[model samples]
Target: MFTSQEKKGIFSLSLIFFFQMFGLFLILPVFSLLATEEVEGATPALVGLAMGSYGLTAALLQIPYGAWSDRIGRRPVITFGLLLFAFGSILAAMSSNIYWLILGRLLQGAGSMSSPIFALIADLTRPEVRARANAMMGGAVGLSFGSAMSLAPFLAHYIGLSGLFWVITVMSLCGLLLFWLAVPVPDQDPVKATQPIGVLLKKVLKQPNLTTLNFGAFACSMGLTATFFMLPMTLKANGWERSDWWEIYLSLLVAGGLVMVPSTIFAEVKNKFRQVMVGGILMILLSFALMAWAWSSRDFVWLMVALYLFFVAFNVFEPIFPSLVTRLSDAESKGTASGVYNFSRFAGQFAGGLTAGILYHNDLPFLPLVLGAAALWFLVRALGFPNPVRHASPVEKPE
Candidate 1:
């Protein structure tokens, strides 16, 4: 289904994505603890800030990075982004305080390469095979998330957070090496100046189909980050030692992946994209509801089931959402459209972290907030998502 060059592009890009995402996830299971315990003046809010500051920078820079890639080339932009990411990892590794850690995270996010990566995939693959390519990239991200969760606790137990950051720095450099060595350059740069920036942005934002998918991305990310902001501490309080987190996450993620694989195949191959997407959103809502119920019960089994559902739903949606965005996008402005989509996603990450932090600090309910957001997401999808096969079709120029 893919040419040799296409295979190289997918493999190299997937590796780039895996390394970057793994670096982020490697810290998620332990960063809050590190912030509160090791860093002086680290309040719950600061901990949340440290966890999410990267998203803020990523959200802000996504569009610019995408646009830059369109103007220059994907290789240079990605290389520069990787360099920045590595520098941030080094800074984070050396941080002595919470504030510095936050700065490091912000710098890490500043390397925003998601749009360019996806755009490059769109550049390389035929439309018929694009969804599969996207699924591969999404699978890379899901695998990285699972691997990080499984390894984080053990790594932290031995090398500590600083050492983990150093590891991330090394991994990022490896990604850079892979990018230069393995990924193919596009035969020709796609024309990006055909549409005015204002016009393209307006079109992308105004399309109901695109908007729905973008909102879904936002809600999914928001719920994931917000839940994690509180989950580690909650689990620890519920008698699960930090060392044991890997076991729970590994089991849930594996089960989730098992489900995700078939669902993705059903969506792409069977052409049930809309149905699968709706089912995925409903699954997310159900997961949040379960999480809300589990919060007060403090039952490890209940929490495990809730998270299992969450990961399943999340994995199902992650690949499909971006594929839909690419499919719905005008070929000319795919980079811009992807930028907007990623902006929505990371913006949600920033919001989720802030919301979780405030709720935690103020002694308010967090699960209910996540549940409400999930409910809202469901409503948006039910009312707005189209039923036509248009979303699964090849990319088209805007009318």
Candidate 2:
């Protein structure tokens, strides 16, 4: 069980994550429409670039951001990152062209606070209960994602994409304020690595466990961006209006959230992390297969099934991966390790949007097949991955 302090820390940090991701995800369902209809000089290729530009910058900067946090402290880095994010949101809100929007996105990604925030979580929580802390964080992110999906289309209809960006700006500021006001500063000093920076990074890169988990992060995020890129279009083809897409997403979110709560507990309590992780990968593979069939047949029922399955699979992965990363990493390089993980994850997001959009415009039929192939490869890699070493049961903090 969490101490009261631990609970406060987790809740505050989770809210920060919620604000950041919620702002970013609010554009997922409606960005394509905004690109096609509103932005001048928008092409299919440009839409893909604009969609992915944030990830590109995020992927490049996460390592440095993480490393900086190790040197300068997490709070300072996180606060600056939130400010950058808000500035970008404001810029994007003002954009009238695709180029400007992409630039805003690129700037937004420059914040790159995920690594430090996660590293801070590791610092604040005990190992045995770390997974539970992360689970709560994942739950916050999941709720934000669900809320974003359920609201995006409806909000876009009423507010326009520009107005949506304004909302994101507000959210970013809220996250900034919450971080300073609520998040507990870790009492522990930063890990002082004896090795050189290059050597430390190289060591992190060489760890088989780290690399495997990194790949998992990449694959999961890639699949997500690609799936969102395709999902709205597929639903449109099946006669669902843009505004009505929220209903499907909301229903699936509720269903997936229910399943996720228990499965995460079972994985942690029963010490079945590897089994749960493997099951999730297989489930993702199966979801792609089902979605492939649905796309071809235009079967609404099958599509819903596939989507729900993906939601469940993703939620399973969300909490488990970071906890595993924390366990697998050494104390000195926790921030760097998380940086690499976030790098891969964001890179995958960029690639997925860019490639999926290209394929969709050039040869729509081949998109799912490509995504399925990636999932298959991910499963093969996951099969050989090792489980995290179990720690002793965590003790609560003193009252």
Candidate 3:
């Protein structure tokens, strides 16, 4: 069990994470619609670019922001990130064209605070309980995604796309406030980097296990981006109105959350990280297969089932992946290592969005088959993943 301080840190960090992700996901459901219908000078390809532009900027900056947090404290870097996010939200709220919206998204990604935030969570907890702490953060992210999916369309109906962006701005500000008022500072001093950035990058990249995990991140995020890119269109074709997507998302995500709770407990409590990963990847493959069948048959019920299965499987990895990264990485270089992992993740998002957009534009409906192949690759890699120590070692102190 966590002490009061650890509990406070975990709780506060989770809420802050929730706020940030809620803002980001809030736009996902309605983004394509906003681009094609409301914004001026929109093209199918540009819409995809606008949707994914943030991932490019975020991927580019994640390493520097993470390394910077290593020298300075997490607080200052996180605060700056939130402010940049808010400024971008404001710009997006004011934009009447796709180009400005894409620029706003780019600026928002430039903030790139995820690595530092996770590093802070690590600083606050011991290795024994770190997975649990990360699980909390993952739970927060899942909840945020569900809430945004359920709310965005309804909110969009009432407030328009600009208003949705404004809501994001407010949520981000709330996160900044929560950080200052609620989050407990860690006791350890910041870890200063002794090696240069290039050396650190090489070290992190050379770890075979981290390499596999990085590949997994790329594949998983690519699958997610492509899935969402196609999901909205699928629902529309099956008779669900744009605003009513919340009903499906809310129900399916809730079911996923239910399965996720038990699966998470089994993985961490039973020390079955490798099994969880393999099983999760398998689940991803099965989900894609179901989606392919649904598409071929135009079966609405089958589509819902596939999506529900997807949510269950995807949520399982949310906490486990980061927990593994932190555990496998050197204590002194936590921020840097996290940055590398997240860079792969966001880079996958960019590629997935662009590829999906191009395919959609060209009338080539190949996302499910492509994602299924990616999942197979991920599964092959997971088969060899080293089973990390589950509470077998003491938390290493920074050198």
Candidate 4:
């Protein structure tokens, strides 16, 4: 449990991130189905493109957002991003066709706020304690996933997809209020503030272990995004309603959250990042395999089992990888480093969705698992990469 200040910081960060993620995921339960309806020309690939365009645009802006945060300070850049996201949400709500929804998600990603939020976190936390802060943010995210999955299915059923978009707009507006009113800025030490970006970049680059870590980030996102793209279709095809699908998603989410704490505690004691990554990769592969098996058997139980394991790995990795980034980065440029980490992730989100979309056009439920095999290969590459030298910087507050 956190003290009062830490608690507030964690909640504020979670709320901001929740609003952002809710904007992204509200359509997950039904968007693909909606896209294939008669009015939309029923092109699955285009729906994938529409769903993924936001990720593509967000990846492009991460580095710039991090730099902007460093140059101007975190609050202003974050606020600007949130406003842009709000604009995107409203535009999406009013869109007439799948093409217009694509435009809206793209604009939303263009104003992605993750980099700025992380930069503020880095500024606020001390070095030694940074990992805990990250854990807090990650925990918040897990909670948001559960809440969003549970709420979105019913909400989508009642209000329709466009209504969900409007709801996201309201959430974003509320985030703007919390960001402005609830968060506090840490006083920066000028010496830390003036470090040149290139200098910081070089310092991080010298770390030999970055390849594996970043690859893991990329692969993990790919697996999850692709899985998500398939999930609604999977459940529906298996004869489950949207409400039943939400129950499945929420159950797995809670199970994942329950496992994450113990896994991290064990990881810390053993210093087993390589082992952790390997375990997560293998588990993800198993989820895909199970999915394949379920399809063969046509059983909902196996499908649920696969999802439960998949999310456990996902929850472990989300916090574990970010903590590792904090551990490995140079003291001065944690902001830029985390931005790049998030960059790899959203980039993977784009590629993952497009890959599944194309494959989906060819074959339905089998696609996500086939891609999962490729993700396993990427993880193999990550495992073979070299390790970073320990800088032994004082552990700071979690970002």
Candidate 5:
């Protein structure tokens, strides 16, 4: 359904996403342990800061990056972002202290490539095929997540966290090269804004449907980040070793992917967007509840079930959310809308990490965190998310 150039663009961008995400997620499983063991004067709060610092910078910079891409070009912005990312990776790798590590993570987040990359995909693909293109990209991210989970322990064991950072740096540089060589330049003219940034932001925010999806993105991310912040420690406390983590994550990821295929097809091809999304949200809520129970009871089997369900729900929503944003937005403001959407995502990441850190530092129960996630999901469902498939073709054109 895609032209050769479109195919190339999709594949190139997918690789860019894969490498970047892979590098970012590679440290998740071991970050808390590393902070306490290696870094000077590390505490739980500091560990959380290091873990989430990237999201803060990324959230703050995403809109600017997207706006700049509109002013200059996607390729230039993407190239610069990749370079920044690599620099951050190097900084992180060289860090001998937690403070420096936090700074490096902030720099990593400052790159904010997601907005421009999605905008570029919108530029390259037809609206009809945009969902498919996004699905491909999301699948790449899922694969990267799986690969990172499977590889992180081994890599950390063999070479240490510093070595992993170096590997991330190399991966980002590889992304830059792939983007330059593989992705074609867009033929479109520069975007001439019909309104100021404030007005544009207001307009996007005022779209009830878009706002619903944005909230969904935020809530989902918040749940994910918060869970991961505690999951590793909980697992360790329950007698699961770091070496065995890969097996659990790999198995869950594979199972999630297996279920994701049919769910995605049902949502996209069968035009059951709302049903699928609602189901996914419910699943997320249930997962959180189960997670809380498992954590409290130290039931390894139940914890695994909760994680598997979380992954399944996460994959279901990941691709659909971005495509929905693109579909709902006018072409003129796609970059802007995408920036806002991504901003929400990163903001959730920041909030989740910070909350997790504070709770862990205070030695509080995990029940609040899980309950908060459930509440957020309930709010998303109450917002009445519209079905993109119902309006897909007609809304593809910009207003």
Candidate 6:
């Protein structure tokens, strides 16, 4: 663990990451209801489009955003992106129509500097301690996610949906200002291996193992996006209030955190990377099947247990995959690989939402349909992955 004073800056960096994500996630549950007023003939598809458009924009921009961060410096590019994000938020907040909302979300997502943010972490931390820094970032993500889901609905009810967007805008601007004023420039520029983009792309994506990693990120995002669409609704049906669903998130994430520590240790120290990933994927698959079952019948306990299991799987795999990505590629292209991983995942988010909206539009149930398909698809992908752990692979390790 970093000393208290030393860790403060990173913690603040983590906080900046958290609020940016919070701004991203805050409208998820509230958007469908809000959309009825904003868009003419608003249907599930358009609603999904409005909701997910941000991720699509984020996906498209991440690679270039990453490269831009590399060229200039991390903070300047990130600040510009945040300003762009805030601009989008203000537009969304002031808009009365869905067209504006969609535009706002697209720009908002495009303005997100996910690659830049992670790049800053890469620039600041040593490789030996990088996993811990990455884990801290993951924790920020989880906390923001839980907090956003819990708070967004209540805030929407009281202040309206636009209010939530404005709040995020304010938060984003504040975060940007803090970064500009307080975060110091690193003592030295990040020394990086130079490679042509075409060559780097060929080397990383063409490698079978990293390709598997890309698919893994895809499956994980697809399954997560699809399944989470139903969980709150399921809880609502079981006499739980919509606002109270975060209790499950809070509880399960606690368990997930405890389990994650052991999983990371066992994977790294004991060098059981492949086995651990297999277990995480299997756990996710089981949770999907279980969620389907719970939804088929009104079984609250089963739903609760399945949610707990699902979050556990998410927490374990989220950090591991990125760390493993670091192992699978040259340092020159590690940033690029991370960008690809995020792009694939966000692409899944876009597809997952679009598909879920379509399935949900009909009388036949859809979250389960999409998630079940995603689960099976991922199981196949998991089977094809080569373990990236240094000790386990006979393949001449990641150079």
Report the lDDT tens digits of candidate 3 across residue range 1-399: 998888999999899989989988888877877678899998878888888888888888888887777777688999999999899999999999899999998999887688899888888888888888888888898899899999988898888889999999999999999999999987766566777777777878888787778888888888777767767766776777888899877886787788677777887788787789999988889988998887777687886777777767887887877877878888667888888888888888887777777776443337678878888988888887867665655432211
Q: Which candidate number maximizes lDDT?
A: 2
- For each candidate, give its TM-score against the true structure: 0.93, 0.94, 0.95, 0.88, 0.93, 0.87
lDDT at residue 340 of model 3 (Cα atoms): 88
Tens-digit lDDT string for candidate 4 (44-90): 78877877788898888886677666666777888898899899989
Q: Please, what are the lDDT tens digits per residue for candidate 6 over residues 251-312? A: 76588788777787787666666778788878887887786687677677986787678878
> How do the candidates rank by lDDT, highest first?
2, 3, 5, 1, 4, 6
**lDDT at 339, model 1:** 85
Greater lDDT among 2 and 3 belongs to: 2
Per-residue lDDT of candidate 5, residues 4-99 (tens digit): 878988998999899999998899888888777888878888888888888899988887777667666778888889899999999999998999
**Winner by lDDT between candidate 6 and candidate 1:** 1
Q: TM-score of model 2 relative to the true fold?
A: 0.94
1 against 3, candidate with superior TM-score: 3
Candidate 4 off by > 4 Å: 1-5, 38-42, 189-206, 293-301, 361-370, 381-391, 395-399
**For model 4, what is the C-alpha lDDT against the true structure?**
0.72
Per residue, candidate 2 scores C-alpha lDDT tens digits across 9-47 of 999999999998899889988898777888899887888
Candidate 5 colliding pairs: none
lDDT of each: 0.79, 0.83, 0.82, 0.72, 0.80, 0.71
Between candidates 4 and 6, the one scoring higher on TM-score is 4
Off by over 4 Å in 2: 362-364, 392-399
3 against 6, candidate with superior TM-score: 3
